[model samples]
Target: MYRKQLFLLSLLLMLLQTAAFAQNNKLRVEPSFWWTGMKDSNLQLMLHGNNISTMQPVFNYAGVEVKDVVKVNSPNYLFLNLNISGAKPGKFNIQLKQGNKTVHRYSYELKQRAAGSANRQGFTSSDVMYLITPDRFANGNPKNDSVKDMADKLNRNDRSGRHGGDIAGIIQNLDYIKDMGFTALWVNPVLENDQPKVSYHGYSTTDYYKVDPRFGSNEEYLELSKQAKQRDIKLVMDMVLNHIGSKHWWMDDLPTEDWLNFQDEYKTTNHRREAIQDPHASEYDYQLQTEGWFVESMPDLNQENELLATYLIQNTLWWIEYADLGGIRMDTYSYPDPEFMSEWTRRVMDEYPNFNIVGEEWSLNPAIVSYWQRGKKNYNGYVSYLPSLMDFPVQNAMVEALRDDEKSWDTGWLKLYNTLATDFLYPEPENLVVFPDNHDMDRIYTQLNQDADLTKQAIAYILTTRGIPQLYYGTEILMHNSEKGDHGIIRTDFPGGWSGDKVNAFTGKGLTKEQLDMQQYMKKLLNWRKDAKVIHTGKLTHYAPYKGVYVYFRHNGPEKVMVILNKNELPYELELEKFAPQLQGVKQTTDVISGKAYNLNQSKLALPIKAPLILELK
Candidate 1:
């Protein structure tokens, strides 16, 4: 018994020693960073440690030098700048010495990069982005619910509250997203919100440098990107440089007074995105609209400050390099200072040649939305490097057509048809970000007055027509806001997200066959596009609308996909021989959604009421 007690005491001592070593062995840094440069660039590192204040670490100096050591605001931090400019290339070791003691020596390898090895920024035509509000998606890890020492974690039950959906939850559901035929996933800001409550949305960032612990560590974010890339899915980061949450860490302890646009008082926005192209908009209106806070709880950022601008731009680049993300979705694109925005886009694109990004303009007018695209004849002459902007005009027209009117002049269906006719306003109409409905609004099914056929038609149009289509998560299985038509209910959790749930979308358990069919149908149509480049990169051609039916063709060279949507209840026969140009006497083709056969040249192809068909010519 004495011998057993002695062993237990020995084990306890060993654990104590290990704990002490771990605490001491930690090579800590603050305002974390990594090194990535155009060619050979300099890197400055700041590490805080005990008894290392005056210690000069030896480095292999692949053309590097320990230029200087400076004290930081915190006594524990010591900044070290390494001059990599014009330095020789070789592997190096970094070790610190304080009198007689030296830290565990660490080795780092540096090598000359080949030409054109650096990544480039720009988006492609063959990409589909799945936008997710990190907080509302899922609470995969509950341990981070109430992190102390930073922000207060309160009730998630509040509708305007934070629900603790972190980056980890998003990482967990990547497989589901990839399976759904989405090539890219956009997560709303994962940075520290630091708000006392309702930070689940993450739009109110306090610290640009720190990853919200509630979402998992920054390393976890990098892991999500790595895992997603392995699955052939690109991660698109949703960035908000316009404004921040009022409770951001910088609110009280700002890096500078100019860190925010209006630190003393709030400015309101005119919200006239059309003002950019508006001939009569006053200067005051433009200033207010672009400078105003999105809300009382949000503080506008000051892009005019060079330091703040640099910080924001650097942070974006850092995330791209660290996470290896495929794209970026900038929120409130028009609100930030236009000059800085152009510079930001240019710099980002300069780094990543093949990257893709989409900015949200949220204007229902084509003139307003088009003004933000890459090439535009703005009266102000704002040159933007942005690849694309959201097609809010088309989305608005579609919803209005399906919900409100179908008439002679400004009526139903006509709104959508006419809107498409104005596609000439856009420099590249096919490169727009086309989304039926998003987080701020009702589900597409609900917006269509629960008309499943109409919903199907809209999906078919967006997917097969032009641009890239983004669908909300629950839209596939016909989830709707039928009872009260609330957005919260519309964004209800997918049954398969939780374990032991009565319904399982993954397994099709406990769901009606109709629900299952809708899910299967969407999967079939979208997954088929993975190989359907004819529909993706094809040119679009359409004639004037006629008799409640619209026909458009997506053609590339010899490959052509004729898409027709019939809004009429009864089938309206088409004069295939006369009007169907290139498709003359064509009969056999495969249905994109159902793999059904169709004889286009035969007696008016059997189409259901408001049916949407995609015929792949044989």
Candidate 2:
């Protein structure tokens, strides 16, 4: 009877201990690790556990102090305001207790930062960026195509399904990108998007701190950044601050009741971009534009929450330092609260002053795009520290000019010329990002009615025009979609990305003569622009189009280069007298493309038919 009673008591104790262990398993901490040295001394550590707010926490670590503990309305969450200004690189622990008994102990680590992390250089006008959709770029590892635990699986045939492109594929093709003379690479978001389907685009983020297993591991992403840097190529990360995937881990158990906007209702956004800048806009309309969700699948983030704001700002800084990122391309820039975005951009710039961030404000109006760029003196007295913005005006105008059938004051080439005339509205127009087309639009070739000559002219304009130039992948070999405005077809897989692909662009296996010519033309133009200092920061002077010819000069000090866009099928005589201000004292000109020589002593120069002339004068 004594032995039986003793065994029963021991079993009872074991059961109680097992229950306690299960309860502790619910505890969680974000940003699992941080660096010891940082510009800001304050660090807000968000603690999550089962009824964690009921406990008091204490830690005794040299150079680290828990200044305050904040408890919100949620019993399962706690925020620790820690001052780690004097902390050294090491590990420490904080004990959470309910009175005398210790409920849990959390271990934290601080790491040493990389060399010159704060002063890292960012993408600039001198660098031409190559934008890529990783899922459509290339597939290097077949094994990681369909991760078991991930909800989505590989289905290459499905336009929107995961097509098995991974970081390894990008690494394999780094040489191809480098040899093409692109100095910077902008990859679409690669964060964990654990949605059940259509998650390949990566905009719907499920995990903020983790890379999607379907794409690759976080370490693999770091390896990619390291390798690209070694080849003198910079990496630009795309980040979304407006919303997150509906399947996000926090959606089921949010940190706070106000974590998401319009949580009680599922109202879609008006997408009326002018609401942000409209003078007579109703408060209700502005609220609807800012507070409404982007889509049913994406829940809008409420940046007005101070805690959430700090969380996002820290998250971006962590990635910048962790991945050693060269720049950040923020998605949906104007959707968030302007005050919070201003603070966010200011904080990031404070940390890395030299680093650049290009915000996406997709309005075709120059005034709307200029409002977000830094140094714009807005009429509303709003200040923005954002360094760059996507030049949608230039992009739209260029396409219209290419598609127009006739040349007139407001048609054809003048459409583009008039669009650029508004440059005075921007404080730093040269910092804008200009491109012909991107993943979101139809390919440039398709927009030009598949005319190779017009396509070459567009490409030449994008490469030589002021501001940074970004080319979407597959543009060189003339990739286009059969149907217009189909994003899935527009972001088609690179020919050689997958296994068993008959044509290999990397090896030039089965490309047509025109495709090969386009590829070589791209290679030459890009390679030359890599060393062309005048195009990077030169003053621009353009003469009005005269008889189907539009001419412009990019000159800096003594260096001079002229670009001519001619639409006439037959050769036209261009009078040198019209460009006296730009072409004065110029004796001879050599074509940068064909190396053909021209004498300025003649009164008129014969411009080639439908040819883009990039001339270097001496």
* Candidate whose lDDT is highest: 2
lDDT of 2 by residue, 284-327 (tens): 88998888998899999999999999989999998999999999
In candidate 2, the residue pairs with backbone N, CA or C atoms under 3 Å apart (3 or more residues apart, or in different chains) clash, namely none
Instruction: Tell me model 1's lDDT, rounded to 2 decimals.
Output: 0.74
lDDT by residue for model 1 over 104-185, one digit each (tens)? 4555544444344356433456767777777667667888867887555745556666566667777888877888887877
Residue 116 displacement (Å), model 2: 1.5
Of candidate 1, the 10-residue stretch with the lowest lDDT total is: 31-40
Off by over 4 Å in 1: 1-31, 36-117, 120-123, 150-156, 482-490
Model 2 residue 510 CA deviation (Å) reads: 1.0
- List the global CA lDDT of all models: 0.74, 0.90
**Each model's TM-score, in the order given?**
0.83, 0.95
RMSD for all candidates, in order, please.
6.2, 3.1
